[model samples]
Target chain A: MANLTTKIGNLTLKNPVITASGTFGYGEEYLDFLDINQLGGICVKGTTLHRREGNPYPRMAETPSGMLNAVGLQNKGVDYFINTIYPRLKVFETAFIVNVSGSTLEDYIETAEKINSLSSIPAIELNISCPNVKQGGMAFGVDKDMAAEVVKEVRKVYHKTLIVKLSPNVTDIISIAEAVEHEGADAVSLINTLLGMAIDAETQKPLLSTITGGLSGPCVKPIALRMVWQVAHAVKIPVVGMGGISNARDAIEFFLAGATAIEVGTANFIDPAVSLQVIQGIDDYLQRHHCESIIDIIGALKTA
Target chain B: MKKFIGNLVVSENIPLKNNHFLLKLTQAEPLPLMLPGQFVQLKIDDTPSVFLRRTFSINYVDRLKNEIWLLIQVVGDGTRSLSKNKTGDSLNLIYPLGNSFSMPTATQSRLLLIGGGVGVAPLLFLGAILAEKGFSPSFLIGARNVDGLIELEEFQKFGNVYVTTEDGSAGEIGFVTNHSILKNTFDKIYTCGPTPMMQAVTQFAENKSIDSEVSLENKMACGIGACLCCVTQTHQGNQCVCTDGPVFNTKELVWQI
Candidate 1:
C-alpha cells in the first residue's frame, strides 16, 4: 500500500480525507455504514459556548449541484460535548477535532479553554468562517485583522493544535490566511461554504428561513480550489482544503493545489460512507501512479 | 447502528390512484426493522437538479418477503424520477431513519389515524401494526377530491377505513375534521399529512384533551440527525425531525391549537 499519511501542522492524519464539521455529526452517525476510525479525522459539529437553537425550519434549499444551509451552529454548547458526547467519542481511535464557533472573542476563548483539557481531542478547528451565523463567524474571518485577533486570542488559551477555518466569501482570502498564520495558528482549513441563496419560483419567496445560506457540493469546487491554491501559496502553514469534495478525484485536485489534506463536506449527506471510499480511492490513485506517498503529490501542480 | 445504507432492487412498480405509485422493493438480505412512521432517504439517480436525497415515509414493510414498499407521489423531479424506476433497477437507500409512532397505552383502546393526500403514506403501515396488536384502529383519511384519496383497500385490510373529500365526491365530506367520525370519543389519535390537515387533527385532539401524536414532513437533507435542516419547534426546544422524530407527541409541539 502506498503511504497515505499527511500532516496538518503538528497533527498527523493516517489519510488526507477528513469529514467536514456539521456534515459528519460527531463520528457516531456513520458507525452503521463504516468504521469511524478508518477516517483520517472527523470534524464534529460546529459547537458554541452556549446552546444555540440554530435557525428555524426551512433552513436548507436544494440548487443545481449544491445545497444551501443556514443552520447557524446549533449545538448544545461545548460543556455538553465534553460531559456527555466526548465520553462516547473517546473510544474511537480516529482524531475527533471539535469545530469551535462563537459570537464573541470571549466565547471563543472560553470554549477553547474547556476543550483544551480533553486528552482525546488533538486539535480545534476555529470556525471563524461559518457564514450562516449572524455574528462572530464569517464576520471575523472576512477581515484580516479580526481573523488574526481571534486566532491570536484562542492561541493563547488553547494549548493544543489550533486550525483556523477560513471563509471563501472574502475578496482576499490569502491575506486572511497569512494573518492567522502570523498569529500562531498551527494550520488553516480553507473554503468554508460560499454564501449563496435560493428562491422558490412559484412562491416567489426565499427558500431558506434565513434568506441566505452557505453553499456547498460540486458547484463550489472550482472556487474552493482557487482559494486553496491562493492561500496555500501565500501561507507557510499547511492548508486543509475543503468544499465540494465528493470523491477521491476531487480530493486529488486539492492535493495538487497545495492542500495537505481535504475535508468532505456535503458529500457525506449523500453517502455516509463516502469518506472511506475517498480514502480507498486515494490509495488506489497513489498505487496506480507508482507514487510512494501522498506527500509526493502535494503542491505538485504542473505549471509547465 | 441498526440503520444502514444499501441497494435494494425494484421488484415491482405498480401505479396507484393518480401520479402516485406503489414501489415494492426487495433484497436477498432481510430488510431492516422499520417502524410504522419511520422513513428512508432515497438517492436520486439521473437527476442532478435534485441534489440531495429525497425523504419518504415507510408505507409498508413485508418482513416475510424481505420487501419494503414506498408509496410515491410525483410531486417534483426527484420523486417523479423515482416513480420511473423499473423492475431490477437498484436504488440506494438509508433505511429505517427517524422515530416511529408510539404504541397505544393499556387504558387506550379506541384509535384514530388521520392522513391527508400523499401524507396518508405512513398511516397504512401504522394501521397494519395497530391491527396486528389487536387495537382495531380506525382511519380518517382525506384528500382534495376523490382521486386524491389513496390506498383505501390496503388500509381496509388492517381496520375500519373512513375518508373525506373537499368536493364531497367520496365519503362524508368537508375536511377530515368535519367527518362525523370525530364526534366519537377516542382514547388515542395518530395523524400524518399536509400541515393544515394535520393541524386540524391536532386542534381536535387538543380540544378534546385526548392523547395524540403527529408525524411531521419538514423538508430534510440528511435523514440522520446530522443535518439540522429538518427541525420542529417543541416545548423542549427545536428538535430535529429526522432523529428526534418524524413522529412526535402532539403535546410536545409548540404549535398554536
Candidate 2:
C-alpha cells in the first residue's frame, strides 16, 4: 500500500485533495453527498471582516470548458463563522482552513486574529488575489511589495499555518510568491482565477453583471501548472497547486509539477466526488510506480 | 429532504409536442418521497460542449412502480442530448432537491396553478399532489399556439385546465392573464413559467389580495447548493435558488411587480 500522507507547514493531511474556497461552501453543504472528514482539508468560503451582499444578479457566465464568476466574496463575516459556523465545523476530523479576504490590511489582520483564536481551525489561506472584488483583492496580489506587506502583517497576528494565495494576473508570479515566503508565510497556493470576460453576441453586452470576472476550469490548467512549477522551485515553503483540475490525471500533473497538496475547484461543480476520485487516483499511481510514499513524486518531472 | 444518486433505467419516452418529451425513468430501489417544485439534475453524456448537469423539475412520480418522470423540452445541447435517450438506457440522477411549494391549508381550498411553455412541468406534479390532498385546483397554461401546448390530458386529470395561446388556436385567444379564469377568486396562487407570465400572475394575485408563490428558472450549475451560481435576490438578500429555493413566496421576492 502507498502512503498518501503529506505535510503543509505544521499540518499533516491524510491525502492531498482539499476542496477550494468559494466552491465548497462551509463544508456542511457537501456532508450529505460525501464524508467531509475523508478530504485532506476543507477550505471554507472566503470570509470577510464585515458581511458582504456580494455582486448583483448574473454574477456568473459559462465559458467553453470553464466558467467566469464575479461573486464578490459574499460571506456573512467572521463573527457569524465564529459564533455559528465554527461550532458546527469543530466536529469534523479533517483539517478546516479558512480562506480569509479583506479590503484593507487592518481587516485582514483582524480576521486572521479571530481565526487564530479558534482551536479547531489550524490554518487560514490569505486571499490576496481574489480578482472579482473591486477594491483590495487583486491589488495586493499583483504587486510584490503589496503582497509581502499583507502577508507580513497577518503573519504577526495569525499563529497557525499561513498560506498566501497568488493571483495569475501578475507579470512575475514567482517574485510575489518569494516575497510572501520571505515575509514569514508558511506556505503558498496558486493561482487564483485568471481575469477574463465574455460578451453576449445577440445582446452585444457583457455576460457577467460585473462585465469582467475571474475565469476558472480546465481552460486555466496549463498556466496554473507552469506557475506552480516556477513557484515551487523559487520558494522553500510548501506550495498548494490549483487551477482547472477536474480529474485524477489532472491532479497527478500538479504533483509532478511540484505541489505539496492540491485543491479541487470548479471540478466540484462538475462532480462533487471528484476529490475522492483524485485521492484514489494518486494512490493508484503510487502503487503502479512501486513508490511507497507520495513524497517520492513531488516535483518529479524530468526536463531536458 | 432525502437525496439519492442512482442509475435510473429509461422506462418510457413519450413525445408530448414537437419539442417536448416526457421521460419516465425507473430505479431498482424504491423511489424516495418527492414534492412538487423539487427538481433532479441529469448528467449529460456524449456531449463535450455541455459539462454541467441539466436541472429539470419533477413532472410526475410513481412511487409504487419506482418510477420518476421528467418533462424535457429540447432547448439546448443538454436537453437535446436527453431527448435522444432510448428505453433501457440508464441515466444518473441526483434528485428530490430544493424546497417545494407551500401546500394549501384546510381553509385555503380554492388554489390556482399557472405555467407557461415548458414551465408547466412542475405544476403537473403539484396539481397531482393537491388533488390527492382533496383540493381541486385550477391549472392555467399558456403557449404560443395550439401545437405548443403539452400534456393537456395529464393536467386535466387533476383540475379544470384553462389555456391561452397568442394565435387563438387553443382554449382562449391571448396570454394566460387574458383567460376568464382570473374572474374567479382563488385562495392561493402558485406559478412557474416565463418571467413575464409569472410576473403577470403575481400582479393579479397581489391585486386580489391572494397569497402567491413562484418557482424561478435561473441558470444553474450544481443543483445542490454547493455552487452558489443559481442565486435569486429576495427581501433577505441573495439566496441560492438550488438550495434556499427554486420556490419562494411572492411576498419574499423583490421583483418590481
Candidate 3:
C-alpha cells in the first residue's frame, strides 16, 4: 500500500485531504456523511476576536463552473469556539487547525494567541487573504510587507505551527510567499478565492449583495495550480495548495506542481464525502504508479 | 441521524399544471427519516450553466415504497435543467437538511397551513402528519391563476383545502389573504410561500393573537449552514435559512408583523 501521510510544517497530517475553512463547518456538519477523524485535517470556519454578522443575505451566487461568496467570515468569535464548540471538537482524532482572520494587527495576534492555548488545535491557518471583509484581511495578503508584519507579530505569541494563507488577487504572489517564509511562517497555502463579480442582467443588479465576491471552485483551478507551482518552487516552506480541488486528479496535479498537502473547498457543498473519495483516490493513484509514498510525486511535474 | 447524501434513481417525473414537475425518486435502501417541512440540496449533473446545488422542500416521502418526491418549479436554468431529468437517471441530493415545523401542543388544536406558488411543496406532508396525529387541519393554497394550482388531490387527502387565484380562475377569486375563511378562529397557522403573502399571513396571525410559523426561501449555497449565504434576520441574530430554519416562528423573524 502507498503511504499517504504528509506534513505541513512539523504537524503530521494522516493524509493530504483536509477540508477548507468555511467549506467544512467545524467538521461536525459532515458527521452524517463521513467519519470526521479520517481526514488529514479540517480548517474550521474563520474565527476573529469578535462576533461578525457577516454580509447581508445573497452572500453567495453560482457562476459558470464556480461560485462567488461574500460571507465576510461571520463567526460567533473565538471565545465562543473555546467555550461551546472546542469542547466537542477537542476529542476528534484529526488535526483541528483553526483559520484565524481579523480586521487589525491586534485582532490577528489576539486571536492567534487565544488559539495557541488550545492543546487539541495543532495549528492556525492565518487568514490574511479574505476578500469579503471590508478591512484588513485582503489588504495584508496582497502586500508583502503587511503579510510579513502580521506573521512576525503573530509568531511572537503563537507557539504552534503558523500557516499563512495567501490571496491570489495580487501582482506578485511569489514576493508575498517569500516574505511570509522570511517571517518564520511554517507553511503557506494559496490561492484564497480570486476576486470576481457577477450581475443579474434581467434584474439590472449585482448578484451578490457585496457586488464583488471571492471566486472559487473548478473555475479557478488552473490559475491556482500555476500559482502553487510557482510558490512551491520559490519558497522553502511547505505549500498547501487549494483553490478548486474537488477530486483526486485535481489534487494530484497540485502535488505534482509541488504542494505538500491540499485542502478541498466548495466541492464539499456538492458532495459531503468528497474529501474521503479524494484520499482514497490519491492512494489508488500512488499504488497504480508504484510510488512508495506521496513525497515521491511532490514537485515531480515533467515539463519540456 | 440528521441528514445523508444519496443518489436517488428517478422513478417518475410527473408534469403538473404550470411549469412544475413532480419528481419521484427512490434508492436501493429505505429512505432516511425525513420530517415534514425539511428540505433537500439537489446536485445538478451535466448542466454547465448550473454549478451550485439547488434546495427543495421534501414534497413527500413514501416509506413503504421507499420513494421521495420533489415539487420543482421551472423558474430558471437550474429548475428547467432538472425538469429534463428522465426516469432511471441518477439524482444526487442531501436530504432533511433543515428544521421541521413544530406541532401544536394541544390535541384538536385548530391548525391552518397556507402554501403559495411552489412553496406548497412541503405543506402536503405536514398536513398528512397532522391528520395522522388526529388533529383536524385546514389548508389554504394560493396561486396566480388556475394554472398555478398544483396537487389539489394530494392535499385533499388530509385536510379541507381552500384556494384563491389572482385572476379569479380558482376558488375565492382573490389572494389567499382575501379568503373569507380567515375570519374563523384558529389556534395556530403554518405557511410557506412568496414573501409578501407570508408576511400578510403573519400580520393576520399576530393581530388574531394566534401563533404562526413561516418558511423562508433565499439565495443559498452549501445548504448545510457553512456558506452562510441563506440567512434571515431574527430577534436573536441573522440565522441561516438552510440550517436554523427554512421554518421560523413569526414572532422570531425580524420582518414587521
| Interface RMSD after interface superposition, model 1 | 0.8
A207, model 1: CA deviation in Å?
0.8
lDDT of 2 at A29: 79
What lDDT does the true structure give each of the candidates? 0.92, 0.90, 0.92
Error of 2 at B51 (Å): 1.4
What DockQ does predicted model 2 obtain? 0.60
Best by TM-score: 1
> Which clashing pairs does model 2 show?
A217-A244
Order of quality (DockQ): 1, 3, 2
Where is the poorest 10-residue window by lDDT in model 3 chain A? A1-10
lDDT per residue for candidate 3 within B48-85, as digits (tens), equals 99988999998888888898899999998989988998
Error of 3 at A257 (Å): 0.8
> What lDDT score is found at residue B116 in candidate 1?
93
Residue A146 lDDT in model 2?
90
Error of 1 at B104 (Å): 0.6
Ranking, TM-score, top scorer first: 1, 2, 3
Off by over 4 Å in 2: none
Of candidate 3 chain B, the 10-residue stretch with the lowest lDDT total is B99-108
Per-model TM-score of chain A alone? 0.99, 0.99, 0.99
Report the lDDT tens digits of candidate 3 across residue range A1-304: 6898898888999898889999989998889889989999999999999999998878888899999999999999999999999999988899999999999999999999999999999999999999999999899999889999999999999998999999999999999999999999999999899999999998999988899999999999999999999999999999999999999999999999999999999999888899999999999999999999999999999997
